[model samples]
Target: MSDSTTSIKTFRYRLYPTRAQEAAMFETLRLTRTLYNAGLEQRREAYRKHGKTLSAYDQQKELTALKEACLEFSGVYSHVLQDVFDRLDKAYKAFFSRVKKGAKRAGFPRFKPATRWDSFKFKQCWNNAKNDWTACGKPVDDGRRISIPKIGNVKIKLHRPLEGKPKSLQIVLDVDQWYAVYTCEVPVQPLPTTGSSVGIDLGTTWFAVTSDGEFIENPRHLGRSLGKLRVQQRTVSRRKKGGNRRKKAVKQVAKTYRKVRRQRLDFQHKTARRLIHEHDLIAHENLQVGNMAQSNLARSILDAGWAGFLFQLAAKAESAGRRVIAVDPRYTSQRCHACGHTGKENRVNQASFRCVQCGHTANADHNAAKNILDRGTSTERGEPLGRAVPSGENGSGVSHAVA
Candidate 1:
């Protein structure tokens, strides 16, 4: 349901660099990691010894001297080294922000290790919007090969042709695989208006409940992959540390977990796309999923992927010209849609709801969803809300049945 507009869209493609190219990229990563650690050390030392804080600009100005002293740094691209300073600057800013917020664990910026530093960004790219080869990492015309600065061109599997003005680019290493991620300015793809509005109640059991009374089943991606994941974890932990066997085992575990993560992302993306297609306005509770995850059901709550789904929905909606409203979540499950009565007695069971004062009853989730929908659409402006199109409505209808 997104309105037509321009938005930044990211595209990911697999990279198949040859052995020599891959080695060059790995060495570049090592150099960047060492530079990052050295920068952090300078910052800490300056503050401790002289009560002086070093800025990214301050440290970056010394790169000329650094390159002369350590000639290996010259082998890396100039912009890449500059971007490392930007990363360090961002990390320090975040660390201070968390400290001011009184976070329990104010994650101070730490030095990077080879394993932790897996991606590097190219801040400078063409503003002209072409996806072809250039100075900063560029993809070729046939979309089969991409060039990395200071490294040779490598074979790329471009599943889809890149479109729009290229903004920024990154080379990321996931486990043993490589991917090229590109951000581009693209026009938003808005779907035909359906006039349907829905309020969704997200849950662990049903995955989602709609005001129209449709229930969606949760796929439980993580729970389903636990068996294989457990076996992989056991193999990794059993292997001797620092050995080739251990490294291989770790990669295996990472790939297995990555599969589960991809599945969850795919599921959420598809689900959000469906809602955006069917509705002009989507209403959902402004749930703090992070806070909710602290309970005993943390694993299940996290596996549900509510936060990711909502974020995706809102983004899609904005792009499509649809509206997504986050309503207050308080008492949505307890409040009765029939007579406005709200109390603990309203919830008869997990799947059933009963209004004690009005003697109105319905499926718990369905009733909650209706209340949520009402709150979202009800306003002083009295603007018309599009009735759900019959062609798109597929709810297994509900009826009153007081127990």
Candidate 2:
């Protein structure tokens, strides 16, 4: 495959560091976080006192002197420390970009608390040579362990075989457990064409309904784990703050939530993979889920995770050489697919749909899926995207030409 590798994927592996190794990693974390906070304060102070913003490069150039002064900084790898400044630089740049766009929440970069800053990255892991990792970071001892600069070889559980060339490594802390996340570049392996297309209607009650009459069920991952979460939360409340017992209780609560998140993520990945494998062209509504969640049904809408599913579907489709099209969602639910009759009366209820003019009845989600398919096909035929044509006795609908 001469095509340039465009797909950048991430892989996570559970790490089992010895107590001493873990302590060293924690030291690295503390040093990097302190550096980040100090850099932020410098920028703010410079701007407030001199009306001049301190750029990342300006602070990065001062690293050598800071390391010489602070003996502890010399203990950590230089590249790892440098990454901290680079990350803060990105945060500041993003904040400014958002403010320029008049975003609602142009949040300034704030100092990260100990609990919030759970990860540290090494800027250079694998050298430019393919499959060759730098001495600072590499999978050694047959992938069972990884070498980190400050911390010695940490035992790792390589659950899945690593693919692609590793570019960087991130050490992450989830509650009390440690993980190594690898960023890699892999060439795409296109799947065989399926020669089929389908439109999907996503809902809270049901995960998805396809124009082909397949109904996908929603697992309600968070809803199912609510009981355990409630119990852990209650335990956390019973313990006094700052106590080791309370911290443990908090971790318990976080563990349950983590499991729920993983479950939801796994479900989305599998569903997206299946859709990509089955359909050459998959169509769905271009839903503004963020805006949709601003109402009373926010909990259900968020829990359904329609946005996550669509994102996964699109990404998988791209890698598989399939097409994913998003159609306008305006009247898909209310309009009658059978007669192209646009009216709210067509929606008998959430699950039922009936066209008054054509006397056509079907499941609401199924009808919407059909309408999405029609819209998507028209778009592929060079029709205006997101345009809904009204059709009735006046025959005001999109016309087709025979080949």
Candidate 3:
């Protein structure tokens, strides 16, 4: 693919490694975690004692000394070891960025225990021309196996054919399972235009409410699995700490949570795909999900996963040559769609919107979606942000199509 038309996309697959390879992977994970923690400590101490900041390169240069001092460090791939420091640097950069924005919680980088350090990246691995994996064993071109340095060829279950050139590989450890995530540079092709447009209202009660009054109900995967999760967690609590039984129980709990996460992710992807397939332009509120999650309905807000859904929507839309706009969310719920009267009384309940001034009533979420649609239309047309048409002003009733 030409550079202008190419985009990067990731595809993940399950990896089945032998017992020895699994042991090696665990050792590598432990060492990587140690390296990350050490890098974090060095940065913290340097700044505290001398008011000096260390770049990733500065810490990376010390890797040779680290390997010389610790035999375990030498066993890990050099690039993989370097990536640990890179991860730390990125975390520190993000923390400072948040601090500059006056965030209440500018999270400091913390040490990662073995359980928390789950993934490592390999920027270059597969060499297609040579039919070899760099610095590792060769991989069969049939997509059945992939070789890794310090580990032998691992079995791969190919669910789909890989397209384009593989650019990077990420080895992920989820609970007790292993996965290889491949990012490839592929050609981006625009889909045929349908000239359709829509605005969406996301909520905990409803997954998505479109401007056309279509409601997608939220699937509370986590809530539904909470009972079983509690049972598994209780089993863990009952077992003696550091015992095999406790470890097994812990894995069970993690597996349950992971299942919930996968279910949520699958739903989000399918929902986003359907929206992008039907509409050429999509609009949604640019919500501060983090701040919203800090409210009284924190659990519900987090479970909604609105941010992740929007992110998926944007990605799909980009690949499909569609536009997804985020409008200002202020007053969207309280503003009277029919009369343009903004009042707290406009939204009498969660589901009902009634304009006190003109006595116009409609589904609260639906009305908000319409206003969002109008704002999006204005934005698309390059009109002033303040311009929005009232519902009855032009005799365009509730049945009017979003486009």
Q: TM-scores of all models?
A: 0.84, 0.87, 0.91
lDDT of 1 by residue, 90-152 (tens): 999988987886766668999887769998877766745554435665776566787778777
Q: What is the lDDT of candidate 3?
A: 0.83
User: What clash count goes with each model?
Assistant: 9, 0, 0
lDDT of 2 by residue, 1-403 (tens): 2243346667899999999999998988888999999999999999999999888789889999998899899998888888998999999998998788776777899998887788899877777756477975587898889899879999999999877777789999987899999877677778888778899999887999999989999979989999889988999999999999999998888899889878898999999999999988888999877667778988887778889889888777766677899888877887777766666667788899988768789999999999888778887778765454444445443322222
* Candidate No. with top lDDT: 2
The local distance difference test score of model 1 is: 0.81
* Model 2: how far residue 180 lies from native, Å: 1.2
- Alpha-carbon shift of residue 162 in model 2 (angstroms): 1.1
Q: What is the C-alpha lDDT of each candidate?
A: 0.81, 0.84, 0.83
**Which is the leading candidate under TM-score?**
3
